[model samples]
Each structure stands twice: as structure tokens, then as C-alpha cells.
Target: MSLKKLISIFFLISNFIFALEIQPTMFEQRIDGSGGYREFIVSNNTNSTLRYKLTIFPGSKKDRDMSKWTEVSPKILTIKPGRNGIFKIFVQTPKEISDGEYDYTLSLKTMDLPKLPGETDKIASAAKLNFDFRLNFIGYAGDLNPDIDFINPVVSTNANGKTVISGTIVNKTPKRGIYCAVNVISGENSLNYSEIRVPVNGEKQFSVTLEPNVKKSDITGITIRNLENSDIILKKPI
Candidate 1:
């Protein structure tokens, strides 16, 4: 579906909440190297107990219309005032998922709440909603799934007797990616570094050299920075 159309649906869905918020406690799907179980965490951010329907976009716009997201639990749950609870949703990847990145969305929607004795309107105004959220899954074909791997401690060498540093970067997303810059810091010594880009399922190499006469022990560590996030200590040797 077109990006504009997809966002419109999210707009409508989020507008219905009343006096409550719904969102993933943690929006990212974290896959360990263990068996193929994918997990998601959802949270309620308000004082009153909340009810929600968890849905997964099976694939394509068609799957969304089919109502394929299986609910993680049936009985309604309660969280004490000023506290939060956890609900786990476990999904098993099919043995034969096509050999590439797959895209999907996990959504938390608030089921309608019963109205007060005299209340006629059912929809809650946006201001009253505590939380609204969406999670996107981008699966990649590499060992670590390009979706989450960010390599730091780029390669470096001596340049004209100066310190130079740089290294390759890969975008682990299943979809196309844009160029991102790395953030670096040097100790009292001058350390030079540059940024590089990698495509989806792709990798690039870069280098930065240290100042002339700079010794290894004088260096502490390198920090890698991206616009959306920051990663550091790519390499540290005493």
C-alpha cells in the first residue's frame, strides 16, 4: 500500500482511544541467537486498567484485511494503580520464509471501553489517550540480520605519520537505506575519521589515521554515532 494510505489508517485507529493510551512498552523486536521465537512487549501507561487488542500485519495489505493477527491473550488483564504489567507474544517463523527481508507491523489498539451511565459519545479525544504506538519489523538475510547490526571501531592506520581512522558500515534493514555519519572522539591526541554508507544487505569500508607520533597505548576508544542512535567502543586494546 502507498505510504500515505497506510498512515491514514493509523490516524483513524489512534483517534478512538478515550482516557487511556496504548503502545508497545518497547517497540523494537529483539531476536536472540536462540530458537526462532520472536517476542514483543506491551505496556499500559495510565492509572486505570486497560484493555487492548494486539494485531500483526500478516503480509501485504491483503493480510491486514483478513484479521490474521492472533491475540496473545483472551482474558482481560489488570495493572495496579501507578504500575505497569508485561504481556508476551511469541511467534514462530515459518520453516520456509523466502530468502530475503520480510516486512510486518505490530499494532496495539484499544478495544472500546464501556461508557458512563449518561455518556453518549464513545470515542476518546486524542488528548485523553495516554499512549499510541506501532512497531515495524525489518528482517534481513545476513547472519546478524542487517536490521540491527552497527559495526564500530573502524579500521585505521598511520597517515603521513599522523593518526587516521575510518571503517565500513552496513545497513541491516530489509528495505533500502540512506547514508549515515559516524560520531568520533579522540583523546588529547588528534584522531581523524570519516563516515561511510552501506545499502540494504550491503557493507562499505572506511579508514581514519591517527596523528603522527601517536602511540597505541595513548588511545582509549572510538565512538560510533548515527542520526537515529549512537554506538561506541568499537575497539579498545591496551
Candidate 2:
């Protein structure tokens, strides 16, 4: 191979080798009338030390800001080779605050690692490649009163010959959000369909497919229940 080609390949390999790894890419926390906190684990898998900066931002486009209620500890973290570090996130809800669901994105970005003396310019530039990891954080506050309704559920078949149910989940409550599983019952066969989260006073469209052997005519009812509390939010005949 040509010398130039070898150098390009070397830089590409180095960039891939230094990427960061994080655990629990997505997490949810419930802050009732009282406040609560959560933690995430970040590991340094590269050969050299790793430095990262943690920041919080609104997770959804509709969310304007979350800094007032959400807090992250140790914004800057350093981990030795093969070592792990922890990032703690805390959410505080005042008593006057309304009950609802809030979303935030916890982002960890790698700082530029120092280059060794006498390193080639090309290698140094490649080593400057930084990696970013983001975790979707969902926070719920106040009394947990989630009202979910299944609307206009229809059964169909997908290209894979699996039974599919399509519909919308409406959260009627003005201050509560719900994350739950949709269960479709057909006589003696009960199939757990899709799991979804509907924000406060919002509705979300969902489609879930069952096994090929599950027939559309066999589906008799659909029920939605809270995953955490197993509370039945809505049930309807299909």
C-alpha cells in the first residue's frame, strides 16, 4: 500500500479506538411532592485518560427550558484508563409546581485529549476527534394520576404477516403523564402489545404487531395499564 493510504487508515483506526462508552443510555425518574435524584455510569474504555463535560438541555423541541428544575453534579469528570466515573442528576419540584412530565437530555461530551510531543500533525488532528453521548431523561412530578384512553383501535396485518394494532392513546389528565403497556386480549390468548408514554394532556399514535399466529378476529379487547403500578388506565373492546 502507498504511504499516504497507510497514514489515512492509521488515523481512522485511532479515532475509532478512543470513543467513549456510557451505560443506561436512557432513564426515567419520578419526583413526587418530594424531590429525587438519579445516577449514571460512564466508563473510559480507551488506553489513555478521558475527560468529559456534562450538560443538560431540553429533550424535546416543545420544551423551552429545564435548567430551573433539573441539576447535574460534577459537570466535569475525569477517568483514568479502564476506570469508571459517575454522573448524578437531581430534579427538584416545589410544592406549588403543577403535576406533569418534563423531559431533559443529559449530554456528555469528550474534551480534546492532549497530543504527545513530536506527534505528526495528521495524527494530532485525528486524535482531536471528540465523542458525545446523550441520555434521554424523563421526569415526572406530583401525585401520579395518569388518565389514558385508547381511541379508534384497528387491527391489520403487516407485510411480515404479523397481526398489527394501530391507534392513538389520549391522556385526558391535565397534569399527569403515563408510560404503560397496551395489552390485546383474544379469548384465552393475551398478547402484550406496544409500550408508550403519553405526555400531560397529549395524545400519541402507536402501532404494535403481534405474532403471525395471532389473528385479527381473535382480538376481543385492548387494555392499557401503568408499567410501574400495574394500574389499569383504560380498557376498550376492539
Candidate 3:
């Protein structure tokens, strides 16, 4: 198979593993409104009951100063060989955090456990759960209207009577997006459909063709939107 196919398969399996189980089964929250707070969870999937420490930190440079902001919560959980445990944390989310999306990583590790016979010192099996925490203060708010401008929004026909349309995307938002679907709507009905993705701050080209003898006049523009909810349309008559 092609390298592209291999990469796709790799990402698919990675995502599946991520959703299979929660490493830390429990969490405790302490906060003043939306200010800073501590969060913790413990997972015990090993033979012996292990002592652990959990830390949640900012996932960006602006949050790097968080070294001093760290909070050491009380020892929280006792994970049996088969079950996980929970821990409480202290955190603060200031009122100014209600603008866009924020990302964070919750790091969990075995506390300074004494070295065991023939055991490695590495405490964490994997990095803490990394995820983008989006705080949309605007609420469900109305969906923003999207404006799409294709890089090469033109269709070319060949002697064999095949029509191919190609184009690119220019996202004008601070947020990244992934294109989910493409629809070729003609008048009241859609003539052709496809699923495609356009990475954030990037462009992609797709070719859609009609059967031999199908005139271009029957085709309308194509609409492209992201899985994260952004839309762009390519007009044909233009």
C-alpha cells in the first residue's frame, strides 16, 4: 500500500486506543467560579498498588509561567489491581478565559516511589491525557456565515467528455478546521457528493466528473465545509 494509506491507518488506530479506556478513572475539582483549579485522577492496572502524583498544566507558552501556579492536592485514590482511583485538585480559571478555545494536558505519575528490584524508574506509561478544552463563552450562538474562495475554482473538459473541477481553501479564522464533506448542488437537487478534508491553513484539490455527454450547465457550484464546522462554496457559472 501507499505511504499515505499507511499513515491514515496509523492515525485511525491511535484514535481508537485513546477512546478505549480512561487512564485516571476519577477527578476532583476546586475552583472559584471559572478561575484556577486542580484536577486529578488515578488508574491502577498493575500487579501492585502503586503510589502516584497527578499534575494538570497549561498546554501553551502563555501558560508556561504556571510553574508557580502548581497545586499539590491531598493523596486521593487507592487503585486496586483491577480498579482505578480518584483524586481532588485545586485550580483557578479567571473570568478572562471565555474568549476562544484552550488546550491542556493532565499529567499523572507514580510519586517518588522507592526503586524496586529489577524495575525501571519510569513511572508514567504514557503522557497525561492531552486534549483541547474549548470554552465558548458565546454559548450556542448563531452559526457564523462562511465565505469560501477556491484557489482554482474551474472545471476543464477533455475530448473524451469528462469534466474535472479543482480547488483550494484559505481559512480566515484563528481556529483550525478539517473539511468533512463536499456537495455539488445543482439548482434544487444535489448532483454529486463526496467526503473530503482540507487541513487548517492549507489547501487541497479534488476532481469530480460527470458521465459522458453530461453538459456543464447542469452542474451548480460545490460546497465545502469542515468537520469542525466551517463552509466554503465554489460557484460554477462564475
Candidate 4:
């Protein structure tokens, strides 16, 4: 190939290699009426300096407009090669806000710099290779009074041939629900314990396998407790 063709291929490959990277792509945050904050890191993995603009928008599962209550510092960032930038996010929730989960997206758009007049067409084309990185953020706010109930508890075997005690937890309250512990007892002895979380007014399915040497008939009772205070919320007999 000619020198120009070789140069063109080099620019194409280089542009693909010099891409941006973000850490902790997905995260969840709990925000009371008092407001809360989170931090994110953006790194420029390319050899050349890069410019980025940050913006917060509603995520696909957004039940309410959360952007209005969100504050992002340093809307614009410039980072050198192998350098990282820090972004701080603050969520301010009003006291009267209803109890529920809100979803939002943090977007980082790479700004494409203009090419010099004498730059080759291939190099200029490569400069247009811009990218956008997005992170999903779910924030929960307001009074968290999650009421959990267990439904249709049963013992079954999974494809892996393990005995599983499957059941569902229904959250009747509007607040997010977290399961601190699940206790299973049989013949006055504890069988299994598990921890899980459930969304506000949502239902979460759970499965816990019995230990070796323990049969389905071993379980006599079951109970679930809240994570915060370890208060028993649900109890039933097997």
C-alpha cells in the first residue's frame, strides 16, 4: 500500500483504540428527604487529551422527574491522557415528596475537536468518532415503611438437582423493602437463612435450598425479618 493508505489505516485503528472508559457503570442510591450525594470517576484511556460534557436525564424506568432534584458538579470536564475526573452528584428531596423509587441516567458525551486545515481526510474522519457513556442511577426517597408478606411457600428441586424452598415476598407499603434475614425451621431446629431486597409495592421471589441430609419434611416453620431492626415481619408454617 502507498504511504497515504498506510497513514489512513493507522488513524482508523488508533481512533478505535483511543476510547473513553467509565467506572461503576450502574449503582443504586437511597435518598431521604434530607438529600444525599454520590461520586463517580471518568477516565481518559486514550493517549490524547479528551473533553467531555456531563448531563443528567430521566432513565427508562423513571416514574417521576428526578432531574429537577439532582445537582451535578463540573458539567464540563477536560482530562489528559491516562487521567481521571471526579463527578459529584447531589440529590435534594423535598419533605413532602411521596415514598417511591426514582430512576435517572448520567450521560458523558465526548466532544469532538475540529481538525486542522492541513490534516489528512482519514485523520479528520477519525476525529468524528465520538461516543457517549451512560450510567443508571436509582434513588429512593421519603418514608420507608415497607410491609412484607410471604406467599405460597413450597419446596422444590431446581435443574441443578438442589432442593429449593421457593417463595415470594410482596411489599404492600409504598416504601422500598429490604429483607435482612429469612429463617426456616423444622422440628424446632433452624434449617436455612437468606437475605434479600424488594422494591416499593413490588414483589420479589426467593429460593433457598435445604442443606444436605435435610429433607423437605424437616421444615416446620418459616419467618422473614427486616434488615434495619431485625423485626420479624412475616411468619408461617411449612
In terms of lDDT, the best-performing candidate is 2
For residues 1-238, what per-residue lDDT tens digits would candidate 4 score against the true structure? 9999888778675664456566544344556656767677878765556677899888766566577788888998877667998888888877677666776788877777665555555544554665576776676776666577889888876676666788887888665545447888787777788777676668888888776777766778788877555578877887
| Model 3 spans with C-alpha error above 4 angstroms | 1-147, 229-237
Q: Give the TM-score of candidate 3.
A: 0.37
- List residue ranges in candidate 4 displaced over 4 A: 1-19, 61-63, 114-127, 143-174, 177-238
Q: lDDT tens string, model 3, 46-93?
A: 443455445555545353223233354653334544466655544454
Per-residue accuracy of model 1 over 39-142 as CA lDDT, tens digit each: 33344443334555555665443422212322344323444334554555544343443344344565655444544344323223322343434555443222
The number of residue pairs in model 3 that clash at the backbone is 12
What TM-score fits each model? 0.43, 0.61, 0.37, 0.53
Where does candidate 1 have its weakest 10-residue lDDT segment? Answer: 26-35
The whole-model lDDT of each prediction reads 0.43, 0.72, 0.45, 0.71
List, residue by residue over 69-168, the lDDT tens digit for candidate 2.
7889899998776799998888776666555666778777778767655545554454366656666767666666667788888899988888888888
Off by over 4 Å in 2: 1-32, 39-51, 57-65, 73-86, 101-103, 112-127, 133-138, 183-193, 217-238
Q: Worst ten-residue run, lDDT, model 4?
A: 20-29
What is the lDDT ranking, best to worst? Answer: 2, 4, 3, 1
| C-alpha lDDT (0 to 100) for residue 39 of candidate 3 | 33
Of candidates 4 and 1, the better by lDDT: 4
Best by TM-score: 2
Better of 1 and 4 by TM-score: 4
Where model 1 places Cα greater than 4 Å from the true spot, the runs are 1-35, 59-80, 114-133, 140-169, 172-219, 223-233, 236-238
Q: List the residue pairs that clash in candidate 4.
A: none
